[model samples]
Target: MAKAKKKSPSSIARNKIARRNYDFIETLEAGLVLVGTEVKSLRQGQISFNDGYINFKDGEAWLVGIHIAPYDHAGHLQHDPDRSRKLLLHDHEIIKLQAKSEQKGLTVIPVSLYFSNGKIKLQIALAKGKNVHSRKEELKRRDIAKDTARQLAKY
Candidate 1:
């Protein structure tokens, strides 16, 4: 009998900074073009979202600045940790994203990476950068909401 592969959780990683620093206008899910070693590394939870962003060129979307650590066992076949990976999206979605991203203060950012029905998918967002004041206010609002919820629960 052959051993079954270990089942992993759906979410691989999230860009928490992107959530905190940007106000999302819209979100979309897209697939990625990854190598075998990159997939293995992602399965092992060896990925980073540092300085990651979406870049559009020649009408195609690419994921840039993300890092997927090289698999230890891959030896000679290990992929580059800093390579830009292509994002797979439909023609209409690509055109829409490209048009929206061209607007001032609007940009596309990777929010989270997860697996859907055995295929890896990336959740991206059209977002505007938040100033420090807005970020502070957001934190304050969350704190108040939490306090209100606690008091209500005490009843």
Candidate 2:
């Protein structure tokens, strides 16, 4: 009997740097606050998740600097591409994030966005930044691991 191939999540879309820059401590899904033109733009996949981040203000989560391109078909209702938008997380989750965020160096970062259950969703994370030296060390370790795997496959 032939085995079924497992489908990877990348079959959708992913932000590679979100994984590389910050260790994926945990992931949470929240509704993205969107305007009509922005939703249309997102459906067309004309959005940029780069340079996006989640931050807490007034005890609510907000996503900043993500670019949702203007809808091409919109005649005069263009939306801001680099707007700071609110993220809709549950009250309980928001409370948790508020507590965790107060600790030094802890931050909420936007991981990615995708459509689920026919609605757009944003994946956000709780993370601690990595220092430059640590980032370099992680790269070195990854290279060594790749080399080791290659050598083993040849045997």
Candidate 3:
């Protein structure tokens, strides 16, 4: 057999709530600013994204609420779990995201994080929070899709 292709260095930890809470509008890949211990923790997939989000302010993009667990081997320089992390993005992308975020009800949220070419990258999404009805509709649609897939497999 031919050798299997390796999976891309994708999504170490994903924010499961982000998908059900918002319609996936657009996704952008951005670099992360991490310290030594934090980077080590992330590489081991010891991070959380449930409440993380990107903030654009004063011409900078920051990732807030992402939690990188303290590296067990740290000797006294452990990083803070809730500290804000800077994100690296192109100037044009920043401008566009800034413009888009100004739209009513639109927000910037982090979808996932992963390693790319030995460096950590974040997947951020431009999203709008779903109201109760919208979330219900999404659940209904997902159930329908699941049923359809199951029926197709039976043939």
Candidate 4:
């Protein structure tokens, strides 16, 4: 019998700098409500999550600042590249996020975009912004770790 190919989770976009900018408190997965062209664009790896965030308003969570490029073959029916999209989540989850985000310096940040079980899911986190001094200390620690690794490898 021919072996079936193993399916892996595929990422469309990632906010690579999010970890450096924010200290994560908790992470959650949510579904996206995307248009046809937007979905196609994501499949083509043409999305960016930089400066994007999740906001709760009117009892709904909305994704803002993500850019999904237009599909080339969509003719004039292409979706808006920068439109705010709805995030599908349970009411309880939304309320939890809202309560946490209401705290000072805490926010809901989109971490990455990926495909799961043939549907697109966004990974988001409740995070606190890092101060300048904290960011510098993190960088210093990272550099020290890298130096120690190099020294050990040289032995």
All candidates: CA RMSD (Å): 4.3, 4.6, 3.5, 2.1
The superposed Cα distance between candidate 2 and the true structure at residue 121, in angstroms, equals: 0.6
lDDT tens readout by residue for model 3, 1-155: 89967768866888999988987678999998889999888778898776788888889999988778899999998999889999999999999998998999898999888888778888889998999998888789999999999999999
Q: Give the TM-score comparing model 1 with the true structure, all chains together.
A: 0.89
Off by over 4 Å in 1: 1-9, 150-155
Cα-lDDT of candidate 4: 0.93
Instruction: Tell me the RMSD of model 3 versus the true structure.
Output: 3.5
List the pairs of residues colliding in candidate 3.
none
Model 2 residue runs over 4 Å out of place are: 1-13
Per-model TM-score on C-alpha atoms:
0.89, 0.84, 0.87, 0.94
Question: How well does model 3 score by local distance difference test?
Answer: 0.88
What is the lDDT ranking, best to worst?
1, 4, 3, 2
Collision count for each candidate, in order: 0, 0, 0, 0
Model 3 residue runs over 4 Å out of place are 1-7, 145-155
- Write candidate 2's Cα lDDT for 1-155 as tens digits: 99977543331245678777776667798887889998888778787778888777887888987888899999987988998999898889998987887888887788777877667888788888787888999899999999999999999
Better of 2 and 4 by TM-score: 4
Task: Please give the CA lDDT of all the candidate structures.
Answer: 0.96, 0.81, 0.88, 0.93
